[model samples]
Target: MASESAANPPLAGKHILLGITGSIAAYKAAVLCRLLKTAGADVRVVMTPLAKQFITPLTMATLSKNPILVEFFDPENGAWNSHVSLGEWADCYLIAPATANTLAKMAGGIADNLLLTTYLSARCPVAVAPAMDLDMYAHEATQQNLRTLARRGVHIVEPGDGELASGLTGKGRMAEPDRIAAFVGDLLREKKKSLQGKRLIVTAGATIEAIDPVRFISNHSTGKMGYAIAGELAGRGAEVTLVTGRTSLPTPAGVERVDVLSAAEMYDAAVRAFDGADGAVMCAAVADYTPESVSETKIKKCDGDMCITLRRTRDIAAELGAHKGSRLLAGFALETHDEEAHAEAKLAKKNFDFIVLNSLRDAGAGFRGDTNKVTFIDRAGREELPLMPKREVAARIADKIEKILK
Candidate 1:
């Protein structure tokens, strides 16, 4: 048993605060607690009053080997369960089987229960695994609440798509116990301050070049990839500045955001920020060209074809590379044909330390998607990667940067 614990010590000696909410999925918390214990974590269970109806506290206590906490104080002994103390004691606070009501309350800052109160007081990282009916999960209000939490740096373990308690087939099932445990372990295992004191600049999204007040030119860049990179760098303790174009995505936690509308604006922002940055990731899909002149008003509909003169926009990555001086600069290339050749050319022309290449012809490897397939090109050669979540790709990028820094 000792050797087994030593063999998988990613979460060993860590304090975990497990909050179970009111949902039929609460029964799964028992298995989760056991798995966490087997992984060598010190597990403490906090349950909502309603959660007791779904699963008994005794079962949880037996698995976790700790007393279950349901109320603010123990009535039998009159011992107070200090939410602040619990919050301070944990390394990570995980809420599983989070119902719509609990999620809404959490979003609204209503801390009527011990678990919610602990959440409000927790200085540790927070995560949630939502469990509810498909309809409730799909509701806009719930999604907005989830987004709000995500913006605040709460890790959301996305629910799986499968049969629900209401006999509906869709999302909103809490992730399985083993998967949840692995996720939490991964979070705890990450080096929290690997790039401390370093500063990085990242540009993201589609730059809009206006031809008229009502008409503009832009690509399909949604900024997901750039945002993920920024978040990853921030997680590694680098002070990140995100120069972003128009997109509704929330700013990553711990990142400074500079909003811009056009390619020229993004160029100015990225250049200014890069002057103080230790490195930069050129992830924005900046426009290659923009209109030479702007129309003051919306162009009236005409029967004849219209033409607008365009000129090349300033190259942000090239300018940064010209002044790179020992500073690291990474660039991205999205191509349709001769992908490797184009990427290689850009790698040399931009003076990038390395380049990330993704081809449009490859499915699930382009803009406006959560997943990407990429290859890393450098003077040392290439490293091909499989299709993965953008967040994972960001981690790989961050890893490379760390190695370079080392």
Candidate 2:
């Protein structure tokens, strides 16, 4: 029996149902099963009939220490393998090497095989790591199927970009076994209802102010930080409204996204969302100014330099702060100089419960990066955090939010 303790990993004592499909990536399933077992999980594998051709069941069964199931009934004994029982027995059902075929079947609720049948009956959280050729993975149908599964609360362990079996170099490779295992572990670890019953507004990305049909002004904010924060909040069971500017990032799981282009549009959406929200995280790098008059057509180069007047755009955080009555609010300040002082000032000025500060001078702690180093400033004091991934930073911010709400 697995023991539960801080020393024990999150997957300890967890029941993991591993699903394998027909793909060249099926060979990786053996390593994945071993990794899950090493993490203290009791793993049982279910495979599609076609998958056995790529990787043998004997290999997986040895690693998992459990019999591999591929059919509904035992041929010799005539005893049925209950899909419903398998689904309910597991804590999480993870389908690695999820081929385009399997994804399509899952999206359409077509359960011709034991794996698909078990997937349909799974009461626990489901995750998939897709593997296919670049073109097939990029197909509209496959993308739609992935989107459908995502919308239905299925976790997607996004495939990596690399050489494909088709001699093409691009995305569609299944994530490595270690990464997949770690993702499952993290999912289980953070799957708590800390922020349950709370509604939150998270503003993200850089708002684009149009100067003309073709010309516009925008910042380098990729909306990553805001998206991370939104994901963290949603993961913690908060009802999140992500008011975002133009960004290529997909909407985070369990978040309701409101797309806006200009600062005015963001202001409108943020204000509307904040009306009923328990709090708001002002993470967007909203444009401070916009062209006074947007030209009807693109302005052509003239002999001399032409000037465009600029007007102050709405201050979303300040406006929301004015109306924040006993509500929790958080703000972010990315500064080049006097970061702590500036953050403290904003904390008071915006009526924020706390303000997160990061300096551009700090390497790997700014826009467009996956990591950040931050300082949390509040009336009580300041807590400086070491450089960490944006997701971890978001979790820390959520932790502070939880304390404030309490």
**Per-residue lDDT of model 1, residues 1-406, tens digit only:** 2234477676889999999998999999999998889888999999999999999999999999999999999998999999999999999999998899998998999999999999999999999999998999988899889878887888888787899999989878899998799879878885768989999999999999998888999999999999999988998999999999988676777899999999999999998998878999999999999999999999898898988899999999999999999999999999999999999999999999999999998899998777899999999999999999888999999999998877
For 175-240, candidate 2 gives per-residue lDDT tens digits of 999989988988887567999999999999999999999989998998989999999999999999
Q: What TM-scores do the predictions have?
A: 0.84, 0.82
lDDT of each: 0.92, 0.92
* Alpha-carbon deviation at 226 in model 2, angstroms: 2.1
Lowest summed lDDT window (length 10), candidate 2: 1-10
Q: Which residue pairs clash within candidate 1? A: none
Q: How far does residue 42 in candidate 2 sit from its true spot (Å)? A: 2.4
Model 2 residue 167 lDDT score: 91
